[model samples]
Target: MDNVRTDKWLWAARFFKTRSLATDAVDTGRVKLDGDRIKPARAVKVGDKLAIDNGSDAWEVVVLGISDKRGAAPVARALYEETEASIVKRENDSQARKIYREPASTIKGRPTKRDRRQLGKAGE
Candidate 1:
């Protein structure tokens, strides 16, 4: 297991848009390892559990390997492993959110050009 930098791991795992952002997340305690907040330069090894609060959804994964550079999706997949239950719950929550969304209104027919010209936002 490589003693990997927290910022680098986050970037390699596609958790942040850039290494700097990853560092910022670490500094702010948005990223955690083994149940404790870690610094941007902290070393991580295989079997370490990472909990990341990424705004919309939280992420939890176990480190399987380490790399300083971001890799392809398949390569990234080898770096850490996510639980099946986490994936299922996130998917179901997403679907539920979508189901409750309001659809757009449909008009009966297109308006004439004159009607379009006459239509204007009323002064509030």
Candidate 2:
């Protein structure tokens, strides 16, 4: 197809797990088309620029093809091509996050007794 709905393309490209999620993301301004915020129903054609922010990582890509149907990862990848600068920026951000990750955020599950005691002591 020459064009596809923004949400459909996002889902087809594997950016979001489901079409509903893609639509919600668009509604919430997490996705943009050609530098302007757009609705999920907006039509996207080949060569259109998109900026997508999914909290953790942001992507800047150019639509290389349009598909309304979700497909395999490799096929989905072919739907869009990320800019060189975007790739470099994402990688740098990832590396910075790894080097500066918060120690407290790394703790998973419930806190141990000692950890609770330490937290209590810090609060006092």
Candidate 3:
């Protein structure tokens, strides 16, 4: 295809797990085209630059191919080319995350009865 819908391209490129998520990201301005915020229905053509922040990771890529179908990871990867700066930034972010993790990430669900008792004792 010469071009595809932004949301479909994002899904086909494996940027998002689902087309709905891609549409949501575009609507929320987490995805941009050529530095401008665009609608999910916007057309993505070859050579178009896109900046996407999909919660955990951000990416800047140049469109290389267009497809509306979700495919294997290798196939999806061929749809876009990540920029060098984006790769470097993602790697640095990964390193930082490895060095320091969020304190709350260690906590799971609700505390057990024993844990609650210990917390109550500490408060006294």
- Pick by TM-score: which candidate is best? 3
Q: Rate the local accuracy (lDDT) of all candidates.
A: 0.79, 0.89, 0.91
Q: Quote the lDDT for 113 in model 1.
A: 66
Candidate 2 ranges beyond 4 A from true positions: 107-124
Please write out the lDDT profile of model 1 over residues 1-124, one tens digit for every residue: 4677989888998888789988998999999887798888989788888888666667788889889888898898898887676678778878976886422222246866654554533212
TM-score of each: 0.72, 0.84, 0.86
Query: Candidate 3: minimum summed lDDT over ten consecutive residues — where?
Result: 102-111
Q: Which ranges in model 3 have alpha carbons more than 4 Å from their true place?
A: 109-124
lDDT of 3 by residue, 79-123 (tens): 989999999999999999999886445558887787677667866
Indicate whether candidate 1 or candidate 2 has the larger TM-score: 2
Would you list the rank order by TM-score, best first?
3, 2, 1
After superposition on all C-alphas, the RMSD of every candidate to the true structure, in Å, is: 8.0, 2.9, 3.6
lDDT of 2 at 39: 92
